[model samples]
Target: FEAGLLETLAPLAGVAVEARVASAPAEKTRKARFDEAMLFTHRGLSGPAILQISSYWREGEPIVAAMAPDHDVFEVLKAAKAANGRQAVHTALSQIVPRRLAENLCAREGVAGNLADLSDKALRRLDQAVNAWTVKPVGSEGYRTAEVTLGGIDTAALDQQTLAVKSVPGLYFIGEAVDVTGWLGGYNFQWAWSSGWAAGQVC
Candidate 1:
């Protein structure tokens, strides 16, 4: 929010960023949505991962994010230290994530000096920072920017084969009107097509 550097851009556009989404609070591990663009908005966060979780985002809830979910940053750093102890720690880290991110994380974590000199404990802390960065938002962007609506006529009230309301002979809820919603990568469109075709058969 301060720098305004990473706003509404793709994940691969510049500095590499791993976006993890945790819709549930009691869950052990957050659902990781990697390689997606995450934006910092006036309210909180908006992007593919944020939007996908927003469909399930409840009020007074928070979404957990991990910057690097793919690998164990601590192990990677330790391995680098064993192999090339003379090299700068940040330099070794740059190979894992984006260089800019590696540098910033290294500085923030106070991970300086030759890897051989750094303790295993310090490396573990840095690993948590890189892979377990969590954020809590006030709320989602809502209907104005939501990708798809999550609810409509209840599934129990409709005929699954034809998508016709049980009580109503002619009424049909197809496409976005039904309760089906999906993730960021064009699943809702597929739902719309299938539901429309289903209703078309009955109509």
Candidate 2:
């Protein structure tokens, strides 16, 4: 049995092939835990916003993205007033998000206390915070569970027209495998389509 095993392995022993393995260095891979909430200012997600921001994510940095719209607190207050008509604007805003979040936001805007006590100035502040609520995301789930990887093959190594590797011929990469990643909405899909189309046309 030993002779037969050696005989079978003889052919494999002579085979030589180069194996390329890529891994993040220990320092680059080490993860730091962060406890903070990430916030977005717009009305929930408008599709591509999250994706665009994530495309620029860097390792080791605590992820917190925010946007403040031009309109201030008064806008939110007025809108709330219109929606609720006679109902309290703060009460109306509270119904949209968690009661606790609403309360905190209102408090930060000095619109807390009793709804009856809300002044025009306080209402304005509430409106601004809501419309431009400084989102604080309590960190992301980390790279292990991330949906899309941000960086990869540098674009400088690929031909913009054909997406062919400058150094390697008949070798092409596209989609998430490549460096270019689209925004969360349909941007990624568009990148897939474009990159795939380029490679298909060339290769």
Candidate 3:
């Protein structure tokens, strides 16, 4: 267990591949493809996907996490079983996700041995773990780890083009100080540069 933990940054790395906030039942049941990687930490979960979703995440909110975002987990695994029933479950799963991740899932779920040994119910359980896993975070890692805050000055109160305060002629609100928050990566930076440039142009 010690060696396994040391080998992976996320103990449940592959299991939480792509995650987004799920505040409602419909949202939780729906499928989504996150264009970012999700990482598992001892604290909870993090990564581009989780980080982007964090802005919408509230305390006590549950997140819908997908292990295999690209394929239908039930049908895909069933097909693999039909083609190679004698193959280990982890072997088949590794073909869908990362090998290390498959191994972790297999160990956690007690899913091992040949695919032929697995019943339809077992297959469904495996599919759910990969496609529709639900996770409820205690809370976020907080501002210390937060890349951006959600709101500041209301966008409506400012000039949309110049980012200048509508009521105050010389005052301007820009960057993270405004109510505009963007996705992770260079998006926020780009907004900063663009908004700063716009504000500078007229201020």
lDDT of all predictions: 0.71, 0.51, 0.74
The order of the candidates by lDDT, greatest first, is: 3, 1, 2
Question: Taking the tens digit of each residue's C-alpha lDDT, what string does model 2 give over 1-203?
Answer: 13443343233332221111111223544322221222322222212343334444344333232222333446555566655556655566655444544555665555655444456777766655544433323344567646567777888998898988999998887888888764455777889898999999977
Candidate 1 or 3, higher TM-score?
3
TM-score of each: 0.72, 0.51, 0.78
Cα displacement (angstroms), candidate 3, residue 50, comes to 1.4
| lDDT tens per residue, model 1, 1-203 | 22332342223244435566566555545333435655544445667766777666666655666666778889999899999999888888887777766776777678888888999998897788676765555555567776788788788888999999999889999888877777778898998899999999979
Error of 1 at 172 (Å): 1.6
Candidate 2 regions exceeding 4 Å error are: 1-52, 56-89, 92-101, 107-110, 113-116, 136-138, 200-203
lDDT of 3 by residue, 109-146 (tens): 77888998998787788788776777666677678888
Clashes of each: 0, 15, 0
Candidate 3 segments exceeding 4 Å error: 1-10, 13-33
Report lDDT (Cα) of residue 181, candidate 3: 85
User: Where's the lowest-lDDT run of ten residues in candidate 2?
Assistant: 16-25
Clashing pairs in 1: none
